[model samples]
Target chain A: MKIILKNICKSYNGRKVIDNLSYEFTPDKPVVIEGGSGIGKTTLLRIIMGLEKPDSGEVVFEGVSHEAVRFAPVFQNTRLIDKLDAPANVRLAAREISGDAVRAALIALIPKEELGKKVRDLSGGTQRRVEIVRAVLAPSDVIIMDEPLTGLDEGNARRAVAYIKENMEGRILITSSHSDLFEAFCETLLLK
Target chain B: MQTLSLSAALCRVTTSITWADSLKNGTARKILIIVFWLLLWQGASALVHNSILLAGPYESLLALCSLAVTSKFWLSILFTFLKITLGFVLGLITGILCACLSYRFKLFREFITPPISVIKSIPVASFVIIVIIWAGASSLATVISALVVFPMIYHNMLSGLEATGSSLIEMGRLFRFRFIDKARYIYFPQVLSHLHSAVLISSGMAFKSGIAAEVIGRPLQSIGNGLYLSKISLATADLFAWTFCAVILAYLFEKAVSLILKRLSAA
Candidate 1:
């Protein structure tokens, strides 16, 4: 389903954060919202995720959208439940996806043996990989990732970009510093 | 490479020596510390020349060893343990329930705040006497202990729930997660950290306060009554032995609770 944000404007404490921003997320291409720090990248993502309502404008999603839509965030901090293992962490959504599916998805991204290890036990790169696997495996229509590759070496970054590029089948709205994320076959929605 | 290997091996051995595994480990160190303390206690007892004033460890152990064979002793210990443990369990459940209610409804939390504060500030002796007159001495220890434990746990859980990560909640909202998922992932983990510490303190407080209640209540064949008898008869050795039992029980309960917590976290 396509999501349309028309002239969305939001201000916190009388200072405009996301000012008259209009964007659309279709299945054809990934949308990247490129801006400096505190430039409302997160605020804009929060609005799309139904976390915050825009001061003006409306966010319309395709087909049977709830009055208040739910979302999953690919936050910079990973926002992992440290006590739970990777498989447990991935299936922490509403539907309770099959354990086998969770295990399989985690195995596909990282090693299966590490699936039982708590998120806190995993190294930084491994944790990020687990988070990526979690985001990819979740059954969400729109995945809103904010600076998904903030902490990674070149090799892991390439691997993460490759995993996202290869596995992300539906509409994805991501904010990134690496321009190479857009060097792909799919169309790009550049949100200024 | 050869010199580096030797240095690396030395570093490994040195780094492996953690304080937890070193300071209190092995019979040599433990025995040495025990002997030093025992000698000091014995010297003090000898100088006092009064068994009622201070009894040596050996004398206390002798009293404890003799007490262990009696059926009444076993029954008293069992009842005492059961009462305190029940109070601890009740406090834990009540605290969690109250915290959940308070978090959900501001009105409920406001209503509960005064009671919790009143309970916290009330003198232990005052409660013990009040509980004794109200409920009698038979189960006074447990009730008092539970009262002390409830506030710490209830406050900790409420704060813990309030401190849940906004990002995770936002994530849950984004994905349209059910209430159960939001609680299990976002709330439960956040609360468990503080809850674990609160439980330990609560358990200890419950044990101590409950025993104090028993001492005041003077219930039949109870550890509390035994303690009272020790004071009346000036049996300092028996007093120390019973005090040792109480301390050991508290320590063991903490260990058992911590172990269960560890296993739960691992799962």
Candidate 2:
């Protein structure tokens, strides 16, 4: 699968955040976009995910409809339903992913006891890990993660990155992060 | 007054100061407060010396006991209970549906605004009178209860739906969640908190307006009918008894509904 961005321009308050940005993203090579703060890394990811339409130009996908490529996002915030427990939160994405699969993905990172508890009750790092597990286990063609390793320690961050790399093999992975740990696992695309 | 310990302060903020707790601690402060109020009432009743004008608490209690023994009294309770509860449940369902519609569609919300505003501002008596004229006394309580409850639930439910975070909604979109899944996982959980509060406030209003409508319309076999009869016959004790029963019933119903909602939210 290939997604091409053509002269995409986006502005907030008359300041151009994305200035005629163009890129070709293929599923074979995972891309890690590295940039400083306010360089529109998140915004560019949003544009790619088809969440924010650019002020000008468009995105074209070859060999797939936009809907056909199921995109699972690990939002900057762990957007897990606070009302649902960890296992339930993962199961919400698709029926194809079983409770056992979700539990297995989370078991190394999260304690078995915490897996049954609501996401709100989990610590910040645990919640982030839960979000990572949710995105990884979901049946999807593309994975877009916005600072998915924000709350984890180095060891845990490495573990989470390793887990994602192992689980999401041969899929289009797009992530925006400053972490050398995350970039080490995927092909890096620096954004200035 | 000593300064409270940290745990004591936490407990005070988290839980109500119940009479049972006070009694367990041998304080008896709450019991004393109640006794003081009863004495005040007794004194006032004696000073008035006219039972027709002011029945004492003792008289009210005696009247309550007598009414409790009668099958007609129980039937009157049941009759009003069914009508008011049915109306409230119907209002709750309609209010949720209308809130969803209004939240989803701008035009429908604008169209319903004037009616909701008018209903909110109109007096219960005016509605009761109109309902009686239009639908007759038989269903007065039902219509009146629903009318009083509609605006409250609609307003609260709309606010609840509005309170749902846009970020969570975006997440739902990304995940390709079905409408039911979005509602169940994202919307319902947030809205249930608001609905719990709406239930607490509106349940009391439903009972009050439903009974007021019954009194005006004189629905046969209702608690309102008994109160109306008491007023005409100058049966002060019976009037006090009926009023007390209304208060108790309203309190109990609110408690039951709140309990159910709390348990549901917990699960």
Best by TM-score: 2
Which 10 residues in a row give candidate 1 chain A its minimum summed lDDT? A182-191
What's every prediction's RMSD, in angstroms? Answer: 7.0, 6.5
lDDT of 2 at A128: 94
lDDT of 1 by residue, B114-221 (tens): 999999999999998888788888878778878988999999999999998787776676666678878877888889987988888788888888888888889987
Q: Can you give the lDDT of residue A134 in candidate 2?
A: 83
Best by lDDT: 2
User: Cα deviation of A130 in candidate 1 (Å)?
Assistant: 4.0
- Checking candidate 1 for backbone clashes, the offending pairs are A70-B173, A70-B174, A71-B173, A71-B174, A71-B175, B141-B210
Pairs in steric clash, model 2: none
